[model samples]
Target: MLRFIKFAKDALLAFPLTLIFLPFSRFFSFLYYYNKLVIWIWKNKGDVTYHDFYSPFRDYKKRYALYENILQEQKLKEESICYLEFGVASGASFKWWLEHNTNIDSHFYGFDTFEGLPEKWGSFDKGAMSYKIPEIDDSRAKFFKGLFQETLNPFIQSHEVNITSSARRIFHMDADLYSATIFSLSQLFPYLKKGDLIMFDEFSVAMHEFKAFDEFVSNFYIKLRPIAAVNNFYQICFIVE
Candidate 1:
């Protein structure tokens, strides 16, 4: 008799909540299936392990080579360029770009919380990738220590003239959450132009990076063409068309 009463009480509590959320659940279910169909029809399926979009280099460093080739082909090496990186945990990738771009006129900016993610990301909690901001040691490379939404606008406004004058813009997105990626993309949409390269570090995670990119492009009516990608789909680079 006690077990039956407990079951009844639990069902009674859940009944109203389920009624309140039923519409939302149905709407999300429709969106999920719609997005799946769209991706299946539109997404490119290239060689997962290697692609020679620009260079023949087919190793772990292929992505870097592809970036270099894009820069060269676009003649951005001789012009001022803007390199923006989101989620600069240890500043490793930011430093690599600074060292490799080798253009005195190029400017690099990195944005991160430095304390890690603001919310949970799959197996990672709120503070999963926290790290101390490393000294970039380069005058052209600067770090903004805060969330992207907080720091991006001010930084962009301050450097609006320089950024607009730059011949090429590159964006590296390492933020591993859907919300972060989508928000950063939306914020940066106005500054993006043809020939700009956007590299996603965690692109393969279907529910996060991929979903964010899909929504961003769809909402903005932006055209993106895949230029390079890793075998496991962990990283992918797309050029704004």
Candidate 2:
């Protein structure tokens, strides 16, 4: 009789709890389906899938291959190019560019906090990737220390004349956040020209770089064609049209 009474009491308590949560469950179900439809439409509207731009490669870094291919195809090394890199962690990629692009007149600029990310990212907390700004011995490369918002505008204003006159501009976006990526794009929008290339390091992160690029392009009515993409989609290169 005691066990039966306990069971009856538990059932009575669960009834009110279920009733209270039922509305939330239904609301979430609706939202889930709505988002699915939106994503479907988004995918159908020119977003390239892995199957659409995959090439067989063995034992090679696809991102570097794409960058080199684009550089060679555009003959950027033969022209006066202003290369800008966002999120210059440890200056490894920046140094690589300095060594490879042998053009005497080419200039490279790198932007970073040097204190690392301002906020938390996936599996990484704030201040992650922090490093001391390395001394780049090359005269062609310059590093700007601070947040992008703090550094980019002042630099752009100061060099507006030179920026306008540059023959070619290449943007290397290693920024891993949506805000940083989109902000950089907006700040540089006035300077972006046809035939320029923008390479994204974390393009496959849907909520960050990919979303930022999509919204920025749509907002600015900027047309872009995918020149190359890694098989895993971690990196992608696009030519602005």
Candidate 2: residue 128 lDDT (0-100):
97
Residue pairs with clashing backbones, model 2: none
Candidate 1: tens digits of C-alpha lDDT, residues 86-199: 999988777777777767888888889999999998789999899998886789988899988799889889989877874588899998888889989998899888888898
Off by over 4 Å in 2: 1-60
Clashing pairs in 1: 48-231
Q: What C-alpha lDDT do the candidate models reach, one value each?
A: 0.78, 0.77
**Which regions of candidate 1 fall more than 4 Å away from where they truly are?**
1-43, 46-79
TM-score of candidate 2 on Cα atoms, chains taken together: 0.76
What are the per-residue Cα lDDT tens digits for candidate 2 across 1-241? 9999998789978766567677688567546544543463345436543222334553235556666666677787567788899999898777767777877888889999999999887888999999898797778888899999999999999878756775588899997987899999998898888888898888766667777887788899998776656644557777788
Where does the lowest 10-residue lDDT sum fall in candidate 2?
50-59
